[model samples]
Target: MKRNKRKSDEMFNLDDIKVYMQMSAKDKLYWLERVAKFLHKITPSKNKKIWERLKERGF
Candidate 1:
């Protein structure tokens, strides 16, 4: 039998958040900021810094 899930404005767990961060750093940072916004946490404004760092690593 299949179970039904409830729909609520709940936040993802830390593990899920980590998974998001494991995405390409640029994408990771973008999602990180979005999740933070949902949880009212502080996150950097731009992903430029992350992109620059990745570029420095020759990504």
Candidate 2:
């Protein structure tokens, strides 16, 4: 079944794309790949340092 899109899900809207535009090419590509594989609509930015911290926290 499909789930409802929440405010949290809405957080991944176009503004997130704006934040992504500020990143370097490699960083943006890395995140683009990650988000492409993400199952949930709530995907994080394509920033490696942030991903590293998330991994460190066991995300």
lDDT: worst 10-residue window of model 2: 1-10
Question: In model 2, where do residues sit more than 4 Å from their true spots?
Answer: 1-14, 39-59
Tens digits of per-residue lDDT, candidate 1, 1-59, equal: 12334447645455555565568878867866887677554435466577679999999
What does candidate 2 score in Cα RMSD to the true structure?
13.1
What is the C-alpha local distance difference test score of each model? Answer: 0.63, 0.68
Give the winner by lDDT.
2
Query: Mind giving the per-residue lDDT tens digits that candidate 2 earns over 6-57?
Result: 5765755565566777889998888878877773346545676687799999
Q: What C-alpha root-mean-square deviation, in Å, does candidate 1 show against the real structure?
A: 11.4
| Consecutive 10-residue window with the lowest summed lDDT within model 1 | 1-10
If scored against the real structure, what TM-score would every candidate get? 0.32, 0.36
Task: Show pairs that collide, candidate 1.
Answer: none
